[model samples]
Target: MSEIIRFYSVTDDYGEFSNFAEYPVTLKKVRWPTSEHYFQSQKFKDKKDQQEIRKANSPMLAARMGRDRKRKLRRDWESAKVNVMREAVFAKFTQHEELRELLLSTGDAKIVEHTENDDYWGDGGDGRGKNMLGRVLMDVRQALRDDA
Candidate 1:
C-alpha cells in the first residue's frame, strides 16, 4: 500500500456555488519510488528541456529566469510550513470549546499551552511555534461557545 497526498486547484469564481460544484483533481502520486526521484527523473528533464528552449532565445533572460525560479521555490516551501502549522492550530482549537474561550479571553497563551504537548511547539523535535494564527482562531471559537 502507498500513501498519497491529493491536491486540487480551483478555477471557478462563483464563491459558494463554485466550491460546491468543484471537482477534486489529483495532481501527482507518490509510490514505492520516492516523489523526489520521480520528479528529478521525468519532471526535471521536462523542465530542463523547456528552460533550454527559452534560454536559446535570450541568455540574459534565462539568467534572470533562474533567479526567479529559485525565489519561487523558497517562497513555496515557507508557505507550506506556515500552512501546516495553521491547520494544526485550527484542528486543536476546533476540537474543544474551552480551549477556544481561553484563547479569546487571555490570548495565545492558552493555545500555546496546548501546542506544547506536540513537538511542533518547540518542546519536541517539530519547529512550529505555540502562538500560530490557527490556534488563536480555535481559542476564539471556544470563547464564543462558552459564553453561549
Candidate 2:
C-alpha cells in the first residue's frame, strides 16, 4: 500500500481536484487560459461554427473577436472539459504567487480528478505512475528555490 498522506480536495456536481490545500487565498488576477483557450487553441465544437473558425484562422483574414469570442467557441461545454480545466487549474497555480507558495509548502501534494480515470494526471501513481500536475508543481517549487 502507498504511504497514507494528507490530500486536499473540493467536491460538487462537477467533480473534485484533490491534493490541493484549503488555503484562504484568492488570485488577484486569473492569468489562466479558459475553455475559451480551448476554443482559441482548437476550434468550435459545433459543426456549424467550424466554417467561422476556419475563416477566422485563414491567412488572409483575422478573427475579429471581442473578449468572449461571441459564438466562436465550443458548444459542448459538458463533454471532455477535463483537459481544458486541467490547463486552467495548472495555470492558476503557476501564475499566482500565494497559491504557488501554498502548494509548494505541501511537499509531494498532487491533483487528482475524482470522476476520471486519468492515469497521466489523477491517482494512477501509487509511487509507480505519472502525476503530471504534481510534477509541475514540484518543478515550480524547485524554480522558486533556485530563485531564492
Candidate 3:
C-alpha cells in the first residue's frame, strides 16, 4: 500500500531494514484506542458537588477549584490513556512485517536501545517519568540485546 510508512527509530538503530513498512511511525502509530469522550472530564475526575460549593469562599471559587481539579485530572488521565494506547500500539506492531521478520531472522541480537524521540514513551531516566510504551519496548529490546 502506498500509504505505508516506516519508523526510522528501529531502522536507524538496526540499519538496513528489509521487511517492514513505516506507516505506523507516520500516523497509524496511535489508533487512539479510545473514544473522543474518553479524554473528557466526565471520563476522568469526579463531578463537583454543588452543595459543597456553597460552603466555599464563594460559589464562583468552588467552581474555579472544580475546574482546576478537572484540568489536572484530565492531564493525568491523558498520560495514562496514552500509556495504554502505546501498549496496544506495541502489541499491534509486533505483527508488523519488519518486527516479526527481525525476530524470526535474528532471533535475538543487538537490542533496540532508546531513540532520540523515545523520550516521550521512554522512561526518561531511572523510572522517573511515565513511559509505558518505552518500558515495554525497552524490555523487548533488552531481551533481544541479550544473547539467548
Candidate 4:
C-alpha cells in the first residue's frame, strides 16, 4: 500500500488539504473565505449567523463561531453535517485548479486529517477517530479522477 498522507495545520506539507488553508470557495452563489468558513456557516440556520462566520477574519475564528452554543444550530445539522462538509470540500477542489491538481497528485494514497482536535473530522492523533474529513476528501479525489 502507498504511504498514508497525513495533514493537520495549514503549514503542514499537504496543507492545501486543510479546510483552513487560504482557498476561497463559492457555494450557493455566495463566496466564502475558505471551506472552513463555508462549512462552519452552514451549521446555523440564521442567515445572519452564517454571514458572520463567512466574514470571519480567519478559519480558526470561523470554527470558534460555529461552535458557539449561544447561536441556534440548525435542527438537521447533526444529520446533515457530513454532506455539508462534502459539498464545501468538493467546491474547493473544483474551483481551484491548483488545489485539484494537488489532490490528484496523491493518487491512491490514503489521506488522513491527523489531529486530536476533533475525533469525527480527524484521526484523533491515534487513528481511532472517524476521520470523516479525510473520507470526504478521498471521495472527492475519486470523483475528480473519474471526471479526468
**Model 3 Cα shift for residue 13 (angstroms):** 3.0
Alpha-carbon lDDT, every model: 0.32, 0.41, 0.37, 0.96
Tens-place lDDT digits, model 1, residues 64-142: 4433443333334444644433433443344445534443544222222222434432323232444343343444445
Provide the global lDDT of candidate 3 against the true structure.
0.37
Q: Candidate 1: which stretches are off by over 4 Å?
A: 1-76, 107-148
TM-score list, all predictions: 0.26, 0.39, 0.32, 0.98
* Backbone clashes, candidate 2: 0
Model 1 worst lDDT window (10 residues): 14-23
- lDDT of each residue in 1-148, candidate 3, tens digit only: 1221122233464432311223232223432222111122222344343223323443235435445553445446555766544443344345455664454354333223233434554445444435544344445445445634
**Roughly what TM-score does model 2 have, to 2 decimal places?**
0.39
Alpha-carbon shift of residue 83 in model 4 (angstroms): 0.5
In model 4, which regions exceed 4 Å deviation? none
> Model 4, 118: alpha-carbon shift in Å?
1.5
Off by over 4 Å in 2: 1-91, 107-116, 125-128
Candidate 3 Cα misplacement greater than 4 A, ranges: 1-11, 15-21, 25-86, 103-120, 123-134, 138-148
lDDT of 4 by residue, 43-138 (tens): 999999999999999999999999999999999999999999999999999999999999999989999999988799999999999999999999
Stretch of 10 with least lDDT, candidate 2 = 23-32
RMSD of each: 16.8, 11.3, 14.0, 0.7
lDDT of 3 at 109: 36
